[model samples]
Target: MKNWFVALGGVLGYFALIFLYTLGAYLLVRSPPWFRYLFGFSSLSIFFGLLARTFHWASVAHIVLAESILIGGGTLFSLFWAFFSKKRPDPGGGAQRSPEERPGKSDSPATFLPAEGGDEEADLPVSRVREEIGTLLDAGLSVLVYGPTGSGKTSGVLMECLRERQAGDAERSILLISCSDGMEDYDLLNRPVPASPQEKARTLRAMAREHPDVRIGSLSRLFGDWDRAEGPLRSAFRRAAGGERLTIVFDELNRSSVSALNLILKVMDPVLGHYELFDFTTGERLSCPLDRLVFCATCNMGEGYGQTRELDWSLLDRFPGVVFMDYDARLEKQMLMDLGVPPDLAGRMVHVALALREAHRTGNLAAPLSTRHLKNWGRLVADGADPENIAPCLWVNRLVSHDRLGFPDKDQVHGIREVLGRTFRGGRKS
Candidate 1:
């Protein structure tokens, strides 16, 4: 009975040491990939050392021999697990099939596998806000979509418009302008065009005949290049005025200059029904009617977006249809699975993203994991890259890079590492 109790005590003590070691490592360790082995080697060494001290079970030589034997066995098993275990297929579940293979399912994760010679664009992850945008466009109302980065505002809307345009009418014109801080009124309305040799000579002769007293320096005006070319905006306006269906998409509208915004406002004035495009070279204004025109703009308006202007309230009022897009958990997970990530793995990725987004909301994190990041992560994981190995490069560094406090917010980074360790531990292998 005494021997039995001593044996029980030994087992309990060893396990207790293991628990403490695991907890400490989890809380303190930065690199999780190597932490498990570190815990195992250190805990076994300590436990064996303690047993030898307390029970006088073995001499130093004997203890060293036992440790070597046990550690060698563990090392061999680890090698087997690393090199051979992965060759076997998963018994729990068969291979995942593409969405088209399974029908009557619209709500589940649609694993998109394009057929031979299939169109990949047709398989893009569908956004919920797309329907609303379509409804507004059909009603002849302009749309404004405001959302966080990577919420699929620009790509989703642009793809949907392009698809619709291709399917419905090839003659319908679509114009996409990615607005920037440097965008000016002239950049939108019109721009100078280099004059051809013949045109320049003709203009110079006509100017000389009309204003012979004009100085040689004033002859520079005879070059006549200003507003000779119509920009995307003007070209779309003219096409819409000519009874062709037109869709104009302005991406990152908040980044546009004040002059560009004012120009947009004037051009979208519904009461006027017709807007004038100035010909700077000829001093003429051509009136273009607004017919069959649909305008849409996307803006990123929140923290972590630098150099973005607060949109004018008047401009916001012009959009009869407004959508606030955000990351859709179900859709995002579906997208991951579609990219060939295991369902369980996809779920965990979405969970981490949601947790990070909450942290961002509370100002604990500078930015959250975006759909773009998740897609990239998913593709790598699907291709057999270890999630734990690539996470630091893909997810962790990205969050740390944008930390407003500094390049790496240590406290925040520690928190992120902890979250990742907790979530990714024992995760599905691929």
Candidate 2:
């Protein structure tokens, strides 16, 4: 009988904890007055019943009745709270308050913008791509990712870094900057630039709260108004290192002119490992204490895009490692499928894209199909448009016409057909 009572007590205690936790959640969710009252009454009943049973003040029948009432009442109250609670008014008229308006806002770490689909743990379809990146990072080698638009290159890098950041490596920082000249002064240091300044500031504050050490800044801002000859670039490098591991990514490095290459030289120079240059604005220069700094740059290969005056050997020699991001039909198909494209359609699309690329590469067609063109074509096809009926002219217009392989009067359609034939033949053999 003693052991039975103890076991009963344990079960009751567990239920009590559950009820209290539910009540706490209800209070947080701002349950309605009636619902709150119901919980209060149920809690009172349970407490008295438990006390009465322990003291033998009531019969077993009385204890059973009290528990039934408490459970029934609590269930009804919780249901009512879930279905009928009225939302509270915005504490400060919904006109958009700053992060400072909320109490203890800074105490909580900043939350990242959830992954693209709001699922933090969903695996990316490009496992091979992820594997390659993991290898580079593990080897302590910087990686330069190159892919056409919509290839998820930027998202992949950011997502991987985010996972690493969450793994408790607090001293590391990952910085991403756009190659655009006008993006200076934007607080890209911590948060991405949302469509408006308010969003940008909110994100920055959130980032500051969560990852206070991870600094985001623009390339233009880093070099803006600083004399290249006076070593502004070197100063920025020291600040970035700051006695910890740093991963600096330059997105679309080729978009910037050859002038930007000079900045690259300063950051990559072996001598920079010894001492830092002082920034004129901040008046601080010190040796970078950290031994690990990874420099990665992304750019379009010199094939389709207009050449930004060839980088001299001095600059080229700095980046000894390069990862060629060639077009991968299988990878593309997998990516499309992950983005909700049907398997059959994705396979067909990838087939056509690769065929067109091969035709162009072998000089069998007047103009090779660039990744940009393939992406546009994929979008159109995914939208249920007939790929064959779409104007080839629309795509050709987007290509660098002056640099096109055989534009204006070449047999472009024939080239596309020949590539399709070869792709189909290969498929049949398989």
Best-matching candidate per TM-score: 1
Candidate 2 weakest lDDT stretch, 10 residues: 105-114
Count of clashes, each model: 0, 3
Cα lDDT computed for each candidate against the true fold? 0.70, 0.53
- Per lDDT, the best of the predicted structures is 1
- Report the lDDT tens digits of candidate 1 across residue range 1-430: 9999999999999899779867777765564434456457756776877689679977878887877777777767666765575466544355543222323222111111122232323323355776777777766678898888897777855457556754776765677898999988787767666788777767777878888899645786645553266778877766666777777889999899998898888777765776555544346555655656677899998646888998888989878888888886777878889999988777777766776776776656667788889889999999998775688788776664443445685446656665565557633233
Candidate 1 local distance difference test against the native: 0.70
lDDT of 2 at 289: 40
Off by over 4 Å in 2: 1-132, 145-171, 180-245, 270-283, 365-373, 391-407, 417-430
Whole-model lDDT for model 2 versus the true structure? 0.53
- Candidate 1 local lDDT, residue 92: 32
